[model samples]
Target: MSDKTESVSTLENAMQLMIQTFHKYSGDEGDKYTLSRAELKVMLTTELGNYLGNAQDKNAVDKVMADLDANGDGEVDFTEFIILVGALTVACNDFFLEYNEKGEKKK
Candidate 1:
């Protein structure tokens, strides 16, 4: 298979592994703790940093927290965390693939 195809397959496998790991650690669907989307976004901001090159901006983090916390709760649950993870994974993969493609073209 071509390199691009291999990279895509690898990313898919990695994402599956992540889901399985989260489930295993947190418990099955019924028993799992679910986080609100807002809570998850806030956690991501703190943990992963804003990918928009503005990690130093506390306002960005606060904004994400505000947007995700629809219920005005203080924390996120597992469901929200998983959704944020999925979104971040896709964005990161796209960025990596594009960066790699550019590097390859240059070489």
Candidate 2:
């Protein structure tokens, strides 16, 4: 995370984007600090539809919410959201490495 006084690097900008994205969908009908199930559904479908691949499916959303709601409070907090993003980032990195390895082997 970048301190307010420091210049924003690319990583810092990405952090800021994550924060912005969270708040963008967090406070509609429920707590301003967390995401309700409905809010989560909209956020997932609208922001990560491609990456999540079936976010429109009700059962998928329920499963995701259950997995992410660490406290079982029926909502997802920022920490849980960050964990999801981090896992996805790791998965994408693995995919990229595999793709590059395949390309190298073909050369």
Top TM-score: which candidate number?
2
Q: What would the C-alpha RMSD of candidate 2 be, to one decimal place?
A: 3.1
| Candidate 2 wrongly placed segments (more than 4 Å) | 1-6
**Can you give the TM-score per candidate against the true fold?**
0.48, 0.92
Model 1: runs farther than 4 Å from truth? 1-46, 50-56, 70-74
What is candidate 2's CA lDDT for residue 32? 96
lDDT of 1 by residue, 10-63 (tens): 879877776665444444333355433343434444557656456456676566
lDDT of residue 33 for candidate 2: 85
In candidate 2, what residue range of length 10 has the lowest lDDT sum? Answer: 1-10
Candidate 2 global lDDT:
0.94
**lDDT tens digits, residues 1-107, model 2?**
43668677999889999999999999887899899999999999998998999999999999999999999999899999999999989999999999999999999
Q: How many clashes (backbone N, Cα, C below 3 Å) per candidate?
A: 6, 0
